[model samples]
Target: MPKLTFNIFPKEAHHGDESVWSNLIGGPSSFSLESRIFHSISICLMGISCFYIPYNLYAGLYVASFSAFIFGIFFFHQYYNSRFNARKHNNTVFGLIGLLIFGVNYFANSGIHGSTDLIWPAYLLLVFAITPYRQHLKWLTGYLVFFIIVHGLEFYYPELVKYPFLEGEGQFVDRISTFPIPLVVVYITIKFIRQSYDREKKAAEERAIAVEISKQQILIQKQQLEDSNSEKNKLMSIMSHDLRTPLINIQSYLELLNASEVDDEERPVLERALLTSTNNAVEMLSSLLHWSKSQLEGPSVHLAEINLLRSLQVTLDMETAHAAKKEIIVSYQIPADIIVKADLDMLQLVVRNLIANAVKFTPKGGLIHVIGEVLAQECKITVTDNGSGIPVDKQDKIFSIKAEPAIG
Candidate 1:
């Protein structure tokens, strides 16, 4: 004898919010959408047949045996399709089973005037639930036309549909036994629909959040690129102004030398003036190059201890000579022993620009002062001149990018 196995309740392993059944069957045959519905319907039919077979045997063994065979075929079809085919054939299989078995059962039980009338509509509901929406009209039209033909046959040929029982009691038992099948179908169908809806809604919400995050990241990247371009433009503007000033002085001196006659004594002085302008241009070019490299690759700072006076000595001497032509008094008060931690090139360029700006603004014979003070743990450097002071209204903007160079 072959052993028989029966598993009415589904067993599944849980992974996060999903189960093994959802992973395996949810693609082609979703548990909440298709497989679960088919399984419930299959089990309901088999369970009903357990009671249906014995009851119909008393009425007639031929009817009971045929019902059993139909039930067996439906059970195996659902089982095989659910496991191997993943319920891909659910709509066609269940539609055929519902149409053929319920149609024949209607006449076999008692033709058009039986409990099959109550069960037929419920079976149709199962077919509608399992099948795709496109097949609805086709199946409904087929079932309705078949129903009309069966009724017409009963009216014209009364002998075709057999009445299994002759009285009220047999009819009562048959009707009561068939009631549970339709009820179970309705309950499971509703459950599967609700579960499928919830799953899809959750997936939609996750996708929406992911899209919002991507949009925010794109906005941040756009802002960063705009800032980078703005900084590059500002640096280029300042470089143009500073670089042009020294080159203009060099070109003016060269033109003057070409146009004018010079004695031996005056020629050396003009050459020294030209040499000073050339050195200023070279210093400005070096600063511009360093600034450009920093902007390109980001700033790399190396700090070391150095005497502040020693570092500024060459810069101060150069500015004094440059200012001597205008008769401006340039003086400094930094101690020879005063030391500070700084990047040497950056510190030298900063000091040179301050003095140069002072020389550019001061009138002939104006006094300029350079002072450095060490207080507690801080070193303060100040550049002051007796040139026209910045106006009160413009003082706040003196350090801003909009601080334009004024004509002396």
Candidate 2:
């Protein structure tokens, strides 16, 4: 089934509430909604007056005819002003004109005994709708005071008033004709109020839902952090207990071998044991430290303009000296002015690690090349060496922490 949506007023009027009464005080900054209401009411009054002017003329009521015609002109003028020259249509002045027109009709038509009394309250309601919220109490008081005074004057001097309709169908027609003004006024006022209430209620509900969702996300993140810390602590305990003893044993044997002379065969075994243990300890510690830092402090990247060539040159110089011991050739092709956006220390660390690995894997007298180039928006750095790379089967795991460390 197709969904059904009910809207009392057009979507434009509902959304443009601020503009509905442009001259009203104490409303939202935009007057689109209020302006819409002003235009709509003006059209309604114009239509009503059009009918009444012809009816009054046919009935030979020149006074009523002239008044209805004037009302028609006033409504047309206001409609145009609100539609185009909105700034010129002062809200309070327009409201007073409506009140004055209705008040005059009250006395001129039948004084306190006419249909004007029936339309007076609704006209005031219309005034309240178009006026600013802050001015509502004042308008209400003024209307009520004026109403009482009119009734008081009529009560005191009944001879001073005139009755427009005779007792019969003419009076009935006048009452029936004036009925729509109040009816339309009340309907529009109630619908506008209801629409505003619904919009505010819906907005509040959405805000509450958003706040709850944020709270849930925060709770989930907090739980994940707790689990990560628990796992890291357990891993730390295992590494400290299991690895430390063997590492210490290797170090003690190296110290002992250094302190005394040993047979060639025993010395090689001790050196090999110390070397294996040292490599394993270094790799394990590196993985553990990286994991712990990430879990506890999170990753932080500080970006700055870095001289890529200078950073790579430094790494190459350090690695080249180490390579020189094995009679390896280390060459670099780096432009001096090549710059990139990166964290200086992080970039240097990464380059040093890559070059050091290349030096370790390359055979004696092999060439190692460190090159950098600017490719579009990125700076590409390459480290190459004439060394046997990782085995095809282990290639995928080379960057993983669990990958076994290999020595040249």
Candidate 3:
């Protein structure tokens, strides 16, 4: 535990075929799955022949011994070419060799009652595993015909058949020894197939998860874009109406003065009105500049120490003048020593909007009161007026980009 535990299987969750185990069986990244299977089975066959060669020799079955030796050499050569040189084993050569050797072994052994018949099916299975799908029908049909012709020859000419096994004991030994060949072939082939299937399933699942995450990110980006567009539209609407109306008021006042339409008491009244419009226009223009800057270079918060009463007094004074036009009484209650950390422009914008809203909603002769108070560690500001209140159904979800800005 202290030192090392080598990861023989590095990419287990969703690994490619370039693992160490994969490379040992077949050339990694270069070989197909079928080629890997071919190499694996060839290696197993080579080992099986090592046992068979000696066993056949001891049993005095020289032809069987020779066949086993040949099988070992053929497979060893194939394994070397495939695993070491990264060469594809010749399927056609391998299939033809199997047919020739087995045909000879059938007659040399006890024809129709020998282990050659037992090994035939396993060999055919190996051929199909290694070869392409299109060649399957060709090999199967050819093997079937060969098998039929051999048995038919034995039926017609009994003298041509060899009886190499002396009795039950001899036949039993041959069958038992030959049993391992098919068993090993089936075991390795099925195991490799199952492993390949599991790897594919795991890779598909990971791809699905990645796709889902990408889809979620796209959805979040879409929501953010929609919110930004809505904010842009709101700013444009405010600038067109608020800033333009005040400038138009100043223009009209100048026109009236130039025409000699205002005189004495009326001139003072017109000057006061003109001053109010100019101030409102300047404030609106300043807010518009901040909005434009934020649009050009994304919104950023700048928090600083602010003298709360002193900063908001200007906004309150402006609101009071607007309220006087409607005969609505406007007043405020704020501690002079109340200092805060906040963005000055944003703080003033929110307060001004709130006071303006209250002035708009309050009836003639109504009282609009602005109050600033300390609540524990935080500061709270409220603009209240004797006006029609929000409905219970509408109060829970009050603010939205789609909702009207003013309600009276």
Q: Pick the candidate with the highest lDDT.
A: 3
Q: lDDT of each model, Cα atoms only?
A: 0.73, 0.70, 0.79
Model 2, span 189-247: residue lDDT tens: 77766767797899999999999999999999999887667656655653463344335
lDDT of 1: 0.73
List the candidates ranked by lDDT, beginning with the highest: 3, 1, 2
Candidates in order, TM-scores: namely 0.69, 0.58, 0.81
RMSD of each: 6.3, 15.3, 6.1
Candidate 1: clashing pairs of residues: none
Total backbone collisions for each predicted model: 0, 15, 0
Worst 10 residues of 1 by lDDT: 1-10
lDDT over C-alpha atoms for residue 151 of model 1: 85
